[model samples]
Target: MSLLTTKEIMEIIPHRQPMLLIDTIEELEPGKRGVGKKCVSYNEPYFAGHFPGEPVMPGVLTIEALAQVGAVVILSCPQFKGKTAYFAAINNARFKQKILPGDVVMLEVEMIKQKGPIGIGKATATVDGKVAVSAELTFAIG
Candidate 1:
């Protein structure tokens, strides 16, 4: 079950196909935190050029997916509705596992600190309960 479907998610965040990495919002807390999911497919455009026989999801895109979840969290707030969240910084990112096609990635982001238009969150992406990537992300709401 999903709290927000891809269409619903698009209504909240300004992302389109190819760039909209998350497939669903599994859990949400408005401006505080959220859990998202991505169902990786071999047909993904990047998989074409990323590799021929051995394809791997890009680490930066994983981070971006996490950031989009964070953006959904922030933009869901009544005060910030219809706004955009831009990356300010990404710190201490670690990619531990290769995310392959057909894997379902669980994206989680928890707001750790925020003041005015700037905020920071602790983000992590996992596949089958194994960590694939983790980072601290900072963003500015504008």
Candidate 2:
């Protein structure tokens, strides 16, 4: 079972359908780390134009999914309750492989540093034991 479902995640983060890419959080530690999953679907709207014949999950969306998980880690903390974590920067982003429909992407983010509302996290997206994307994300809570 999931540690947090999409419904519960909705309460923690201010994201709605289409924009809310994280499907379930398997593990979470407030202000520390989070592991989540997103199952890509062929019917996704982006697929309609991303490529008609060969649809692929956009790299930016994958990164957004990672950030959403990171938001969960940040917003779940009692001290940060009701706050929104805005994407301040994305560094060292690398997309290794294409994510296709029907693939379940494993999203993980670990808080590396934090001071007040500014923080950074090491994030990664993987599929079937292989790394698909990795990045360092910076956020400012508001």
Which candidate number would show the highest lDDT if scored against the true structure? 1
For 57-82, candidate 1 gives per-residue lDDT tens digits of 99999999999999999899999998
Report model 2's TM-score to 2 decimal places: 0.99
**Cα lDDT for residue 99, model 2?**
99
Clashes of each: 0, 0
Q: By summed lDDT, which 10 consecutive residues of candidate 2 come out lowest?
A: 74-83
Candidate 1's displacement at residue 132, Å, is 0.3
Residue-level lDDT of model 2, residues 30-105, one tens digit each, is: 8999999999999898999998999999999999999999999998889899999999999999999999999999
Please identify model 2 stretches exceeding 4 Å from their true place. Answer: none
Q: TM-score, each model? A: 0.99, 0.99
